[model samples]
Target: MEWIILALVAGVIGYGIVIYNGLVALRNRVRNAFSQIDVQLQRRYDLIPNLVETAKGYMAHERETLEAVIAARNRAHSAAQRAAGTSGADAGALGAGAVGELASAEAALGGMLTRFFALAEAYPDLKANQNMAQLQEELASTENRIAFARQAYNDAVMTYNTRREQFPDSIVANSFNFTAAELWQLENAEARQAPRVSFGNR
Candidate 1:
């Protein structure tokens, strides 16, 4: 009888330990995913200035668009900092919708930059500037990295969400207050973006 009681106690302890460790692993994975996003965001922040300068010389008249981009970048930077500072909070400090709006603004800014480049094509001098070309290349690369990071973040969120919704893990997660993560979803403007169809004049 003594051995059976001891065995039961040991089994319960082992089961609890397993649940704890599993939760920890999932939490760490979610964190690592966020770190990946942070790295990419930092890269984007670093690259934005050069991009702005490159577009400035070429599109001085488009101050409104440029200002919008800068404002959006600032908002995104602030939100990211807040989200980082708010440790263990399930609801984002800046709210998920705000973050999504900032992301949409970045996309709009990118599209505007494309328009700037198209405008620059008319000016051979700007296109030929070595500095502008380099900045453009770096900005393009940074955009690609951001896309990859966003995909990774979404993947991590999915993993975290799955654990929160699963069987034994779900119970443990609730007991410990583990929450699901949000993905970088496109905003309404992004959805409303019409497909570009360039056709020769009829």
Candidate 2:
């Protein structure tokens, strides 16, 4: 009877260890996925200034729109930095509020970009400028990459959240304080799409 009880205890302990390891792996995966998104977001932010500079000469009269784009870019960049824990927080430990702030900032930036492009459409010379065309193409490409990275990050978060919530695993997760990861989601459906960067004729 003593041997049987000891064997049962050992088995339970082993199972708990496995669950803990699985949770750790899932948490790390979530972090890695967010890092991918951070890289793409940083690239997008870097491209915005050049794009605005190229438009500056042609859209001289549209100063408000130009400034709005730059301001939005700056806000989004700051939010990304916060989400990435560059503010001295633990990396990849984004709470729901942090993720929401990042999403809101990004959506605002996308809206500003859309408005900037709509205004640019009026300036035929700007549309025709080779430098503008190149910058637009690069921004469009970066937008697509951001979309893909966002999807991957969301998927990883979903998986991590689901695993942590499962029975038995929940015990380990709760005991170990493995907090839930938040998915990155834009509030506006239109904002979810890449901003229209095409400068071609209508």
TM-score of each: 0.77, 0.94
What are the runs in model 1 whose C-alpha is more than 4 Å off?
A: 87-122, 188-202
**What digit string (tens of lDDT, one per residue) describes model 2 on residues 1-202?**
9999999999999999999889888888888888888898998899899999999998899998899899999999988888778322333246547778999999999999999998999999889998888888888988988899889888989998999999999998888888888888789788878899997663
Q: In candidate 2, what residue range of length 10 has the lowest lDDT sum? A: 86-95
Model 1 per-residue lDDT tens digits across residues 76-179: 77767765554345532123454465466556655655555555565565666777667666666666677777777778777777877788777877777776
Q: The CA-based lDDT of model 2 is what?
A: 0.86
TM-score of 2: 0.94
Q: What is the lDDT of residue 201 in candidate 2?
A: 68
The TM-score of candidate 1 is: 0.77
**Model 2 stretches astray by more than 4 angstroms:** 86-93
All models, RMSD in angstroms: 5.0, 2.0
Q: C-alpha displacement of 46 in model 1, angstroms?
A: 2.0
Task: Indicate the residue-level lDDT of 118 in model 1.
Answer: 53
Check candidate 2 and list the clashing pairs. none
